[model samples]
Target: MTRTSQVVVIGGGQSGLAAGYHLRRLGLDFVILDAQTTAGGAWQHTWDSLHLFSPAAYSSLPGRLMPPQAGQEYPDAQHVVEYLADYEKRYELPIERPVRVLGVHRDGGLLRVETDSGPWRARAVISATGTWWRPFLPAVPGRGDFGGRQLHTVDYRSPKCFTGRRVIVVGGGNSGAQIAADLAHDPEVTWVTQRPPRYLDDEVDGRALFDAATARRRALDAGRTDTGGVASLGDIVAVPSVREARDRGLLKASPMFTRLVPGGVEWADGTRAVADAVIWCTGFRPALSHLAPLQLRGRRGRIATAGTRAADEPRLHLLGYGDWTGPASATLIGAGRPARDAAREIADVLA
Candidate 1:
């Protein structure tokens, strides 16, 4: 086994797999490091009932086609995992699974990556480890005090779990909206958010959001970072899920309560809402502790993502950044642009 691979890609999820496949097609010697025992990244963490809003046709990696599912919506997380397994088998990419990367440090002109299983050296490193690293929940004053099994959207699995519970889902992003809609159908769910997302409707096609993402990427490539953000003015008019919640009266268009008191949460408007559970739909921040030495500049833990996909960190390349990656870079339909470009950039450095 060659200890020194020319390139090392960290992660085995969709983006990492895509990057690895692109490197293979480019004829670059590389290895993919994944922390999970499986290939799918967040898919493994997503709730069981989840299915991608995007259809299967556009979800394939650049070279591989998602096996056709004529009338089905995009495959669920398990299906994605199965597809990934097939992809790894079909491509024969060198992937070391369950290899938790502890630290990535430069040693003697080589990048040394220490993992739980072992160590590897490479000339280039691509952190394709998608953006779902950390689950963000705003610190409520008495969150622990009134706790009735609180969890982030990251830990949420199915509406069935909240079937008989008075659930309060927080946050206004895509995940929160979808989860709220799903839970609303259970007759025991009600949602409140601090700020309503200016969410775009999930049209039959997600092209608008995707295209906006592309434009945002262009701006980033041109050295812009503050251009794209909540597109709405405290209103979620575009999202199908959000709309459904509204239609069902399950969603309350109000800011989150000021604090989570001993028995319930206090809304901003001085209304007290009590519930058996509070689901923090709060967004996430990038957990890049492994890249501590990179000195990435950005508010919170989010690096100032810029360029083609903005997943291009100065010291690393991230593939599955959030919706900001643009139309062609955000979804399975468009993530290749960044992977290929990042591959070339890595190639240039390691050449």
Candidate 2:
């Protein structure tokens, strides 16, 4: 069946919902196509004990404030999932689930969104698919030869299963740090990072980190050369569990290993450590496979975007792909601006 709309938002996650909110406010005829059968986007797949670095107030989408969980300091993944589901229900956003978009191709004056269900002809398409689907694992020598189990963060559920096992957690990002901390109480776990892990002060959490990033962005936009007090968000925040782990001296990270050997990893100094399993905390690439038909990806495999709109394709906008799409678009709080702006642009064009 062929369907049509003034705008077709290609995801039903936080970013897509934010954009839909604005589009509805503008009275635009639109639909949101979500690949997942349920709500919550990638938060559904995160580890069992995963919690947001920021508190509920700082981690909310536009229009509605995420309510704080009773007696909980930091909202966990399940809390986020329930909130997302409730948000969709509260706003009455038009969402089509389990409709996996296969590809997007230009169709004369309109854009054709080819999906498993059918093709959607839209005046504009918003590609809000986030990075969860595209997990990135760096190629290490003898990776295939390693007889032990290896799993990326996407497949990770809990550290309970890894009891009494020696595991190597690779990457220095928040996920790496959090996962390492989660496993600290269990069997031996080693964290490997290319550089030393920067531990932010106790008071500084995701909110402070985001504020610093916003300041730096503003400074750069104003063409200022000096950003003295700005700190990168790459540093690990002192979350409660992480802080506890640090107190236990379990937050110590080691230098990255050279290659994967049978049953374990080999370091640069010609030393090998035997391991029962390896958990790759490596991050993800943007989930842009469906957009490949557009041929818009530039250097570093990212789409060349002007604000949220595609630089080459004016009728297309991308959201929640990280800083490249818009500052903090990947976060719950940050996605609103870009989404609002994208919807406005699309509405203007359709007008």
Residue-wise C-alpha lDDT for candidate 1, range 94-146, written one tens digit per residue: 99988888877776677777888778887777776665777777877788788
Candidate 2 deviant stretches above 4 angstroms: 226-234
Q: Please write out the lDDT profile of model 2 over residues 1-351, one tens digit for every residue.
A: 889999999988899999988998999999999999999888998999899888998888888989998878889989989999999899899999989999999999999999999999999999999999999999988899888899999988898889889999998888899999999876488899989988788887667766665666567678996363324544677789898998988789999999999879999899988888899989999999999899999899998888899999999999999876777678887889899999999988888
Residue pairs in collision within model 2? none
lDDT of 2 at 265: 94
Best by lDDT: 2
Candidate 1 deviant stretches above 4 angstroms: 197-199, 202-204, 219-252, 294-299, 303-315, 323-330
* TM-score, every prediction: 0.86, 0.96
- Give the C-alpha miss distance for residue 8 in model 1, angstroms: 1.0
